[model samples]
Target: MTNKKKTTIKDIASVLNISAAAVSKALHNDSRISDKTKIAVRQVAKNLNYQPNHLASALRSGKSNLVGVIVPKTNSNFFSSVIENIEQVLNKEGYNIIITQSNESFKKECDSIDTLLFTQVDGIIASMANETTDLVYFKKIKKNGIPLILFDRGENNLNVDYVGIDDYASSSLIVEHLVNQGCKRIAHIGGYKRTRIFNNRIRGYVDALNKFNLPLDKELLIESSLTIEDGRAKMQQLLALKNKPDAVYVAGDYAALGAQQVLLENNIKIPQEIALVGFGNEPFTAMLTPSISSINQHSDEIGKKAAEAFLVHAKNSSFTQTLNKIILNAELIIRDSSNKKNQ
Candidate 1:
């Protein structure tokens, strides 16, 4: 079987007995081209099964209409929800997205950035990896003159557009609730201090403890990768202490689950013996045997705002000069793990 010739502007022009330029203008609905000519050209193009070369068109317009999104991981409900909302908003604006996951690896994040740049995306929206301390890779995105918007996991040092929840306030809320429950010796299983959000949460936790006139015990404050395995290790470390904490607050839901597993394995009662709280309000937080208390980061709102931030920069071309920061308040969802009063 022989290959069929692809239809082009000349093919439509030949059918209409018009110049190829006129056919091109008509297909694009240029104001100079008559509506009658446009109608005829479109009908002929459809009959010829003409498919527009979007890449060529995009090159001519200097816009791909494609955005790249990077996230640490997608298995978590929070990141997945954020991605869903980002796609919904961008699709409505005639833009498409390419999503990439870093799996919390810095090298993987750098590779994702390189891949997105290679694709010539109009803009990028990202949530940084746990190990992304160096901002050099992010600077490469800025040097390319494309808008970069970050969410959930970001650094102020990048000085680009960002949308996220008030992590500091969320931590404070957890401390206040635990304080009200008469937890004097509280422990914190938090993320690495290198990450901005986790640093803010650490600061908030420390200040909240001070505000309540509680002792700032260094042993109780452990910086981790925020993985479930690390959470179990940290929790075990806490349990080995002669003076164990009465309550524990974890920086992530998965880590909190790991801590819960350790507590249960040791026959320690939840909420009664050791209260617990986690951040990000993952669905499983409420599904466990002893439902975990967590902070609601408003994943949908964060996603929408992050997409909108990228749009603003893409339209205005001002991300290089004017930085946009949108921080939403977080809500604490009280549950069985931290509700000592009910227990």
Candidate 2:
């Protein structure tokens, strides 16, 4: 004969000869219940294996306590750190997380948003895909009364909570550092500037050169797909130029890695014949043959601020009425790659 299924609250109450409410109160440690009765009820519940249904309770309370988060690129270290931090904060606040990566596709991003909404998420946090221009697609979240928090790479025109660093200032900082390194003729390898972050960096690069009275050489400015292979091609094209750059500023380290590899293949000296600086101080930067100098994106703090913003919106009933942007500060990380002394 098969054993019967585990007992429910009703079974516990029946065995104890008391009301289901009494058993529940006793299990929840209600002060109204006498100490003797609470002990007896708890013992009976333990014996009968009564379990409260949290999902049913949440449904009755009109709260799922679930947050949906979407990111464009997840392979990078910065994204990994941001997700871990968001998880830490959400877990502490007794909320659950649903994570999805869009891989920089608008269609996939939209589909992910739909799935999250279908799952009854209370709120959403997202980093827009590089190719995403249809901000109105996310208007459904607002229509459903869900607060959307956008972080890192996001839109300024949209009405949503945003947390990120001032990429413009950070870009300027890196440019100034390159200038101070005695590189008068500097070239920039630009990433996909359609995204807010890359565009800000490109602007910063141009502004710095103009401020320094250095002409923006069209030949020296190279556009990259932000991949190693693409960066290698950009570097090769630059090397063929009549006047090669003394210093090159790359937007992403993954591209820089490809460029560095090409430079070695061509016997191009780093920081000697050509200095290199990159954004996103990735872990591999420090371990490379010549450590890459880069802008510290403050990814950990960005995640922390995102968590704080989520808490603010989730806890405050008037959050929808109040809108504010939180921008974090970033600094330059000097390493062997950009140091003239390294050679």
Candidate 3:
């Protein structure tokens, strides 16, 4: 069996009885080419199943027209939606995305950045890994003069464009809802304080408890990576306490799911024995036995804003000195787990 030769501009030129250069200009929609020739070139190119050489075009134009997107993980609906929106916005502007996942590993995140750079992407949009703390690797991106936009899990000290929700306000909203449900001894299963968003949530949780005149017990405030396993361990620790919390607010939905599993295994009634809530209104939160109350992060908006931020830099040759910090308000989604009235 013989491999078919890939169709080229020369093939279209031969079919249309025009110069290869004419075909090239027509394919690119160059102003020098006539409309009739351009239409003829496109029709023949389609017939031949011609594929444009993007790499060659990038080499000639000095712009790859490719964007890199790095996320901690892509399995969650929130990240998935964000990515979808980012692609949608970028695609309209004739740019494509190269996606990479860090799996919450700092080394892996660094590797992803390196790989994206190697690919000669026009810009990068990323959400930092949970294990990411060192800014040197992130600083490298800026050092290269590539546009870098961070969303959700980002470091402010890096001084780049960032798009995320008001995590502190979201946490306060969750606490207020729980307090309204008659929860006094509210516990928090939160992410690490080193992460900006988690730190904000922790601060909000503490302040909201104070605002409502509830006991701000140090024993009840525990920090972890906010993974499902972390949630299970933290929830177990909370359950073993002599004075158990009347409510538990987990910083992540996966962690909240783990906490709910532990509660079910122990035959503890949800909302009655202990109300439960989670962050990032994941779809599974509503599908649980007692639907988990959560905070909506507005992933679509974040994705769009992040992509737009990158475009702001991409369109302008001169970099903007002012950093874009888009902080959107999050909404509380009440469900059976935390809504005592509904329960």
Candidate that would win on TM-score? 3
lDDT of 3 by residue, 50-141 (tens): 99888888998989999999999999999999999999999999999999999999999999999999999999999999998898888888
**Could you tell me how far off, in angstroms, the CA of residue 215 lies in candidate 3 after the best superposition?**
3.1
Report the C-alpha lDDT of model 1 over 186-226, residue by residue, as the tens digit.
99999999899999999999999999999999999999988
lDDT-sorted candidate list, best first? 1, 3, 2
Q: After superposition, which runs of candidate 1 have C-alpha atoms over 4 Å from their true positions?
A: 1-6, 20-28
Tell me how far candidate 3 lies from the true structure as C-alpha RMSD in angstroms: 1.6
Candidate 2 structure lDDT = 0.84
What digit string (tens of lDDT, one per residue) describes model 2 on residues 60-175?
Answer: 77778888989987889989899889889898998888999999899999999999999888888889887787787678877888888889778557777888888888878877
Q: What's the lDDT for candidate 1?
A: 0.93
TM-scores for all candidates? 0.93, 0.91, 0.95
Q: List the residue pairs that clash in candidate 3.
A: none
Model 2 CA deviation exceeding 4 Å by range: 1-18, 22-51, 321-323
Worst 10 residues of 3 by lDDT: 317-326
Query: Backbone collision count in every prediction?
Result: 0, 0, 0
Ranking by TM-score: 3, 1, 2
Task: Give each model's whole-structure lDDT.
Answer: 0.93, 0.84, 0.92
